[model samples]
Target: MRKGRDSKCLGSIIFVLVFCFAISALPFASAIQRQKAKIEKHEFGELADGIALYTLTNRNGLEVQISNYGGAVVSVKTPDRAGRMADIVLGYDQPQSYADDTVFFGVLVGRYANRIAKGKFSLKGVEYQLAQNNPPNHLHGGVRGFNKVIWHPREVSRADGAALELSYVSKDGEEGYPGNLSVKVTYILTNANELRIEYSATTDKETIVNLTNHSYFNLAGAGSGSILQHVLRINASRFTPIDKTSIPTGELKMVKGTPFDFTRPTVIGSRIDQADEQLRFGKGYDHNFVLNKKGKELSFAAEVYEPKSGRVLEMWTTEPGVQLYTGNFLDNVHGKAGKFYNKRDAFCLEAQHFPDSPNKPSFPSPVLEPNQRYMQTTVYKFTVRGAGRGR
Candidate 1:
């Protein structure tokens, strides 16, 4: 009888201890589960037309500040391995500075990205002439492209993320393009730390369209000096070679045994100074990589890793090509927080159809008719490596 009573007492004690422990852990578990994705809207500033700028922030510690003036991404803050957030995209502090920016900065470029030879292209036997802003060629949409236009803003709801939808209509004969193009761009910030950009367009007339975002990214945090120490891996076995004018020669050259080969995770500075014809022409890397995928699917394009911050940025896109620009011409330009942006201060991974694709019939076609909708999706997924707590 005594043994039976002792056993019952021990059992009762064990149950009480376990119950107390579970009760103590309940609040912590609830706190974690309550950390859902969120969206916060705030006024960034006012443009010349008095239109207000806006910002979006999600629960994953990612924030993007944008302006309707040109649908520019003014700032992007992401967390490092230590959970410390820092701005990684280069831009100006004042909104008006972007309006006067000679460099593309963090804005959208369109109509045609790269260059069109002699500022001319023949579409259906009609020779369209564009502004020769780049001297001998038409560059980045002919002086005033979509990057220079204001877009109307609309807020969208996502059950698992936050979104901002922007729309603009490109007038016929504007920038020497033939069609009245209607464009829609959506920016989504997911709880998984993904910055997804989806682009869609429809044209009234048959014309060529190539669009991309020009965000100078430095994973070590913007204004933190050279990104040469960073590692890059582009999923391409071939690349487009450029000419003296930085226009593609309409040839896809193999990257094997060449300085342009990034088949593995290699440091950017490893062969940047190598004596190669292509390097001399670009003055650095200002070329496009032929992505290894069918043009229709969203697949991995490239990845960049910043060792200092242990931040990894993986790019996935449906576009057939990616332009890797090393900011070779960024000289003495002023950026945010009293920092001077110089050559190779940052890099751009512009996902799009190949450069000068309209002229290169051999390349993927950028032509869109009245009935066909042009759609492209690119995602910049950020994640931190190393031991630390993630928000």
Candidate 2:
């Protein structure tokens, strides 16, 4: 009887311990599950119609908010080395404010992202004219480009990240381009702390297409201060010089010994005020650098570092050129959180084909044929510079 009682007690203790162990592990398991990617939808505001905003959050807690109105990236929250998060892209507080955004903010630019000389281009012996919104040259598609239109949005299922897919259809002769262009842009916030932009387009008629995101980034956080202190490096030896009207001169000028030389990490404002004609024309650094790439595969384009915040931004793209545009045109515009954005407050690294490609026969063609599909991918990866990694 005594032996049986001892055996029974041992069995009961084992059972109780097992149950306690399992109960203790529950919170840990729940935390692991919470680390998975997630997405949420919220009503932004009405433009001419109501619009929706989709927020994509990755495993690392990085968040990106995008809207179907112009497919704009409303905000991007990232953490610095100290693990404090802040919004790094510039934008207005309200969705309605984006409708009157002249600096482009974080919207998607399309049709012809950069410039077309004299607002005209010859395609297959036919001359086409476009809106001279920038005066003498067409800029960012036209008066009503992709940035000003609404897009269809849907959630895309992905195992590696949270994705938002936006689609738009441009009617034939819309924005003075001859095509019924169907475009799809996918914004994926990956688990690796990267915001990947995938662009694909198809057209029924032959037309010119160059699409890019115009996100003004201030790595130290938007509206906090000037981005002139940020360090920048571009993997390129040559750049396309622009004319007085901001149109490319059709020459791939060497960046060596010029203010455009960002082959090494350098302060953005170091040479911005130099007595160079190109800098004078742009009022700062606003030129396209021909990337040092061999093929159409995705390659490193540029990297930016903000020392104070220890934040780093690396860019990779399949495009042949990147247009670095300092916000020299921002004229004390009111922005989010009651902050005022002024000149040099932000910077943009737009991955795209060379400007004026439609007019410059020597440049890479931006034409898409009827049966061919246009595809482009650009990745903006965020990281932090560890201690002693300062430039």
Which candidate comes out best when scored by lDDT? 2
How many residue pairs clash per model?
0, 0
Error of 1 at 121 (Å): 0.6
lDDT of 2 by residue, 1-391 (tens): 9999999999999999999999999987787678879899998876666588899999878999999888899899999889899999999777788888888999999988988888899888999999999999899999999999989999999887999999999999998989899999999999999999999999999999999999999999999988989999999999999999999989999999999999999999998998999999999988999999987799999999999899999999999999999999999999988999999999999999999998888988899999999999999999999767878
lDDT of 1 by residue, 114-223 (tens): 78888998888999999999989998898889888888988899865778888999999999999899999988888778889999999999999888889999999999
Off by over 4 Å in 1: 1-36, 387-391
Q: Estimate each model's TM-score.
A: 0.91, 0.92
Clashing pairs in 1: none
TM-score of 2: 0.92
Write out the backbone clash pairs for model 2: none
Least accurate stretch of 10 residues (summed lDDT) in model 1? 44-53
